[model samples]
Target: MFTDEVVDSVSIQSLWRKSQQSSQESRGCQTRVVHSAEAEAQTVSATISCTQTEPQYQATQQLFPNHDELEPPGLKDFLQRVEDTVIRELVKNAKSHAFDGFQVNWEDHSQLVSCLHCLQHPSAHERGLHVTSVSWSCTGSVIVCAYGRIDDGDWSTEGSCVCTWNLDRRALNPKQADLVIDVPTAVTALCCHPKQPALIAGGLYSGEVVIWDTSRTQDPVLVQTGMSVDSHREPVYQVAWVPMQKKGEFGVLSASSGGRVLIWTVDSDQGRLVLNSAYALVRQQVPHSSSSSFKVSLRIRENTVTNQSTLSEMYFRLKTMLVHVLSLSLSLSGEVQIFDLGRRSLRPAATIEQGDQGQAATCLAFNCQNPHLLAVGKTDGTVGVWQLSTDLTEQSPRESAQLEQIANQVAE
Candidate 1:
């Protein structure tokens, strides 16, 4: 590197002091008025550079810090220091009951019941299509209805429609639905997704299981089980959503009068339902036992049974009991069968005769909030609500022993 030198002027001060010598001596010493001295007018100067000459070094820091480096010093000590204080605060909170009496009772709970809203689709009604199945969304704010010919036994080319209504909407329309999905055939069963608010599964009269995403405006069809070997040969009476092995993915469980209950995984890209598992519930395999006649029929009615797949808090072990609402359309006794899945025997654990004992039951459902409340629909287009006795839902040693004795006898 080339260096440049800068010259700067130096300043000097001249001083004079008063002297104690006589004026004569001062005059003799100061003989000349001005003194002149001549010599070489050059000065030697030294330049020193202050810039560092040592070699410069540069190093890059790592983008990600090591795990050991992330740990702070004396972490155990810090936690120990605050541990006592935290424990003390927690104990104090546990001893306190600030929210003990803040219970809110919002249920009307009146013995009297009333109708809220009767929703209908005008086009479906005009086409002589009646509702075959109805289901509520997981949020309990939306209701889905499947319209089909429940009375027609033969094959129908008539088109049907699925309708949904958002009851929470401010401008609720009873004569119209928020969303209407048209179907080529009658919809036999309808079930809303358990967790998803927009997903809906429907079983068609043609034995096709379809999943519809109401959120999609262009095409609500997410996936469908078209005419294939896996498809049911008869009308599907029930369709339910089941959890899949993968997280956040749901599969469909469909049952048909053809004695098959099939489970399918939705393949969205392929637009089809892939068969995952299948179960055959054949009515012909009914055991002709010498003691009891157990007519195990999957056909609850010509149409889908109301709440056929509903799980009750009775028998499936730890309140997972499944309530089998048997249809009595062919029987005059109008009996509803309660099958306890907790037991292996095919006999119903308990029999309930509610409403008109002679009337035939078309469908039935139990209230989820109250186990004692049961609603039964008759073949004569009548609905009856019955409140069961407390002893029926509760544990009775006498009933248990009686059932056990019967089971032992059957075994013998």
Candidate 2:
């Protein structure tokens, strides 16, 4: 059961004032100094206005029932408060640690992954390394990719490999695995496409991007190479495939170490496979690049069909594209930018850098069921979920309203 509580006027004012104060604190001294005089004048004017309306406001406040005293905050308010508290705590945890990572459970709760006893000095013939990249496949299995030196004394030689873990059984068991690709360079990034169960993409330390089809256990089918265009000069950080449409037109998008985003289309025509680069999106061209921290994160969404009696004829007649590419990029300074395939360039969709400094966003994942919801993991070991506006310029009001309702229910 749930109930909504009408917030008291005084409480609302207090919350607003606190938020303003926090904003002021986030701004540097120059901005604060510049706004101080204006703030004082505005405060005096507000004081005079409040004095004139104090009696009327008190009268109105008295006329309303004292629901705050009787019912307090119900389930909705409690859940919102809990979410705020969790976000704050995660931010604090991230600020305190340098080596941290996050993993989301099946229930969507972000949990900090433990890195215990995994770092050890390699013996005469072995190397000691730590897990650098991780991915979860459709089969519910976890794969950890490592990159480091082979031994404590031998820094001349480096080794990297993918270790598969059976998450369902809660054990690291790659000993009997049928296939394992050994790379001469370090593993920079790894991703398993949502629709292509047999395909896996890996970015290497040598600045090479390799796509592998794991259907054949003995040898993986090499589909494409990403190093020729200098797209992966430093290292490939992230790779993902754009969600496919009903017509089966799909493409893969990858973000490299140099902050370049490349869109590669997957063509399956005439019984052959082809991966072609369609677009290259750079982040510096977008607004607010000075405050950004990381490269763009890519995601895809599938539109749904719904029924509205009054608009059914127009709805069915209107052709809607099912697939879209949504990218989230965090600037090195503290800005998050979002872009879509239809847009001319990337834009700042949402920013969440307040109270977070010296922290780097390491990973991002989107909710399969809710495309508007996204989870971002930072190097400080904190994960935050963000909800986007459901109003779609290309979608109907009924669909947007439904999505808004779902988001509201989930937030509550």
Candidate 3:
């Protein structure tokens, strides 16, 4: 793994793999041809050849010649390499100094984006209640804000609220808000629907998930309070919308601090949200090694992060067939676990570590354009970019046929 610093942006280019190697024999020729279907298009053909020959050695009288070696690097080549190294260091330092002094120059035709408005409650503007979470609509025209406070004990909803602001307006208008929800519980997490811009999902400190429709802001459209032990045991740390497998049907996935992942389906006809299923994450144990005759006990190290709490955040990669979750622990160590959501159980398929001894991750984001790339932000103001590659086995023709038949039957 290569660890490179990224101060501005990072990107990966397309990778190409060669299917065949060049021939070992000398003086070889190869030909390749391309076929075109359209009459207007051109058909091309090419030929390539390789030639190798041994050099004939001859004795020659040298007149004060000091360079006659071909094995090691010569003096001139060594000096040139040293000079290139010095030049590289100089360029790196110069760029670092320029950025540090805020001397960056931008093109005249470039556009700059700045904040145009700010929103805050009039009565609580000065003593500002802590903003716990925020979310953006699918169209990027509205902002949803949630309020809460940090407490040693369980949180209460004395002055908590959920509000939305119109981004197209120039100023914050009290009457311009399309939705303002007053709840008796503190809102901890918020997520917007992928297809519906007006639909919103909020997770509360009371372990309840509620869905609100902006068209009718009087109250929540659907509330799953889990009044009869059907909800999460702990606070819901994160919530995300899952892409529906079937048309016109959608679901919401929530992650809690109790190592539970719950899937809730939306029922528009009944105006209700119901829990479809729940998955539990279990701690994995290392197996003992066995020899020819007896078994040997190998000492294994314990993970401090796994012993403290469960998942902190969740991201679902629709194309990769994987679910990524960040762990919440007492220590500063950050850990991410990947699970195959296609399986019945929730055992982690892989685990990745982040941060140093005292640093922790603050946020994480996956590249939608490139499913194999992930970006993580640390508490120390550093970012880590990683590229992931998965090993998938190919199935035989008979197995593939059987799977296709099963899928066809299910569709029928």
* Winner by lDDT: 1
lDDT of 3 by residue, 1-412 (tens): 8898869788975443222333344687777886668556677999999997554332222443445655465877788879989999998897784333232223221111111333454433343444555666776666676665543365564656777776556664743344667767777778877778888888878888888888774666565545435578777877888876798777887777776667788766776667765655543421234321221222221221223333232223221222222221222465444443222235443444554555544444443434444444333333344445432122344446656774585455
Q: List the residue pairs that clash in candidate 2.
A: 127-150, 291-334, 292-331, 292-332, 292-333, 293-330, 293-331, 293-332, 294-330, 297-328
The regions of model 1 sitting more than 4 angstroms off are 1-110, 287-412
The candidate, 1 or 3, that scores higher on lDDT is: 1
Q: After superposing candidate 3, which stretches have Cα over 4 Å from the reference?
A: 1-113, 123-128, 151-159, 174-178, 268-270, 283-412
Q: List the residue pairs that clash in candidate 3.
A: none
What tens digits encode model 1's per-residue C-alpha lDDT throughout 1-412?
Answer: 9899999999975443234333335333445587689887888999987866444332223444556665787997999999999999999998997644333334332321323554667887566565576666777677677777767899887888888877679998878889999888988887888888899999999999999899998889889999887679999988889888898888898989887777888776787888876665655655555522343434222122233453211111111223222211223466665543333336544455544466555444444445555544443323344555453355345446655775585555
lDDT score for residue 121 of model 3? 48
TM-score of 2: 0.38
Off by over 4 Å in 2: 1-126, 142-157, 169-179, 226-231, 244-246, 266-275, 278-412
Task: Report the candidate with higher lDDT, 2 versus 3.
Answer: 3
Predictions ranked by TM-score, top down? 1, 3, 2
The estimated TM-scores of all candidates read 0.49, 0.38, 0.44
Q: Rank the candidates by lDDT, best first.
A: 1, 3, 2
Q: What's the TM for model 1?
A: 0.49
